[model samples]
Target: MLLNHNQSSLSFHSELYSFVPEDHILRRVHDLVDFSFINDLVKESYCVYYGRPANEPELLFRLLFLQFLYNLSDERVIEDSQYNLAYKWFLGLNPEDSLPDSSQLSRFRVHRLGANRVEKVLEHIVKQCVEKGLIQSKALIIDSTHTLANAAKGKPLDVLKKAANRLLKGVKKQYSSLYKKLPMFPKLEGADEEKAKQLLQYLVELRNLLEDKLPDAEGSLLEKINTVKQIIEDERLLTNKGIASAVDPDARFGRKSNSRTFYGFKNHIAMTEEEIITAIHVTPGNEDDGKQLQTLVNKTREQQITIDEVFADTAYSRKENLTFLQTDEIKASIPLNPAVYGTREDDKFQYDKENDEVICPAGHTSIRKAKTGRTGTGTNPCLTFYFDTNICKQCPFKDGCYNNTKEKTYSISIKSEEHIHQMAYLDSDEYLQRKGLRSNIEHKNAELKNAHRMTRAKYRGQFGMRIQAFLTAFVVNVKRMIKLEMAHSE
Candidate 1:
């Protein structure tokens, strides 16, 4: 039955206007996330204490969560929330209320929930997952991707020299015009006009020197001088770009495909079998995955979670990483680079597992000669092998075996005793299952890049980028937790 016109002016506060009504997904998020946990982890003292006192502590936090969940910049979030009904409903905001201004959000981010606070939030979520038995910490997949910084390309020396010359000429003309207007301008009491003249003269001299020497300077010295000259002439220092991020110094330039390069910091995450992130590290974009493996493993250990196996690619297959993982009883299922195995010159080369030797195609056995050791790189001892020179000299496969004039020597580095064992396990069904689990971490990366819009950070500088990364990770964990809770309830 349709209601009569205007419903006879008998409208009450209908449930229709009560957006979300505790049944929406966002409402479910409010239920799954223990606000007390976030409060405990992120201290109130860090936030703005003097702002309009609000009884709802969740207001500030929800704003941050919205940034990550939607991957919107601070300004964009405020703009959208002010006009968007869905956003207001999602954030538990009433229709009458508008979002906080961009400055307020920025201040809140910089002061209250900074990078450290965001990390604590992420840790708390991980802790919740751990307690819920949703994270199987025994197996982990570790990887890193480069993030580009917001720095600009440096200017050329010739351009700087030309610009400096133009500026010096203009300054001279301006000084002449001012002096003409006031005949005693130079004589003004306590006036540093002389100092200004001296500085200008020095600048002119310096510009002349630069113009003369720029063509002769070689290597990085030339680059350094040119950069300085550009800064002086342009009144602007060199930066990757104006976008300051707070994460790492060595932001790397990375290519995701044939044409796109991501400029920022590398985000390293170790995901467990249950697809929960066990550990996360925001490092310089240039940091290698192999170098970070041990540190991440240690961090996982710090959480009181034992990492029994690590799945990664060839990049983390360095000897040092393997040795460290082995000592910690962590199995690393890193794929071997086919190049490392070397190609068989002839079909006769066979590897011997029992005697730890290699049999040459010419029927000559290559025996272990000396155990060479490498420090700093890894604790693994490299076993050197040499074929009998007498046998090699007359062998039918001599040409194929010996590239050098001397006796043929073949060396293989055994990083761990467990390498052979793990290699065997890598072929087993259990290892395959772990590999399957490892593939899921890429989905998390995709979510960050595609869904969360983390591919290019809006902020510039290491610290800013770190804060952004932490917030993004925190949002991901919250979303996962909320989904898990909903599934459990169902």
Candidate 2:
């Protein structure tokens, strides 16, 4: 049933203050947060004199915020608003007020506040937290968790079949002559695997024939052809039954670890030890966590928060990342990948930077030393040190040190100052003490998944996931701020 959103016809009489508890969570949050700033944050999103009569901007935002705060679905949020007294009071509505349409929230996110604008909402709220002293940006904990896409592990052939049929209708509309020449769109729904494969190949043939006529086709049309190309033409498409989503092509197969895998995106987050989220960045499931460390820290900095220390798991360790953190004076609590180094005994070798020589395992030193793989810009370059083969070949423990190969010599080479700092940090008590704080982000990630609906993504594609992620961070941060406010009030 369609909801009647006509505000003029609704009754306005209600004693909501008497109905709600003095210390209600939502009520306290409502009192603590000055949502009036939201008007300015979203002012440009609204047109002064266009479109039909719309719901109030504050009303839309409050209801949308409630979704992640309570982990309610679109239909569930609207339904709860009608019966839930707290929700009614939060929205400033009387008991008999007409609820906004459920679908309207979806439309509002896509049209009114897109991914970019919603990001602004999260940042603005986080800035408020910073100003109120609820969260400090001196140290940040970073982590990534997988959110399953709104798609299934459907067979690649079945995925291609849908894309092909959608393209068939388009070709019939745009180029009738070519459409007639192509084979008729085959029916493959619920068909046997062999039958589906045959039909899929036929569609591929038709698409190839059309490529000569219109080489620049895109959108759903181009997606349809690529769907087939990814399945047949690509060698590594899905040999192990790996398949990308047909609806949300941006989502890829991601793994929790070597043992577990899920098809969706990774939500990389930065938070303080107080468990308050500062920023969020979502990437395809298979994206490397280390690559996004700087991006996440930069996001927090954009809100005027300074990140002096970073805590993350081993996945976020890279030579470049360690160099970046050390150079910026931000202490990194990330453990370097042992694979980045040589054998256990080889770690005993020390560097003498002054003479540009490496002391070998048997007290022998390399005569020739060369710098390899310099990182960062000039004036502050971090150079990697490599020793010559002549000194390494004559070592008593050469078999154990060099692993009997020319490549192993370079692989085991000492990475100047950056590696030294990382090793010293690993041996320090501060790394052990601060390393526990990294788990704070894991708890935060769990809250997003277990309490919030981040276990499975709601909206599709990168833009859609971005909208959901920013809103999730926004809702979580608000909750954290209120909790901190209550604690401080006590």
Evaluate residue 261 in candidate 2 and report its C-alpha lDDT on the 0 to 100 scale: 83
Q: After superposition, how far is residue 4 of candidate 1 from its true place, in Å?
A: 47
**69, model 2: CA deviation in Å?**
1.7
**Candidate 1, residues 152-257: lDDT per residue as tens digits?**
4222232233334444344344445532332121222333434433343444455455456345655434434443343444332123331122122235445555
Evaluate model 1: give its TM-score.
0.66
Clashes of 1: 31
For model 1, the local distance difference test gives 0.61
Indicate the residue-level lDDT of 166 in model 2. Answer: 67
Backbone clashes per model, in order?
31, 0
List, residue by residue over 388-478, the lDDT tens digit for candidate 2: 6666666677776775565433224444567667879888998887677777777788888888889888877788899999988888888
List the candidate 1 regions with Cα displacement exceeding 4 Å: 1-17, 21-23, 40-57, 89-93, 153-249, 254-263, 304-306, 336-373, 379-410
Best candidate, lDDT-wise? 2
- Where is the poorest 10-residue window by lDDT in model 1? 1-10
The lDDT per prediction is 0.61, 0.75
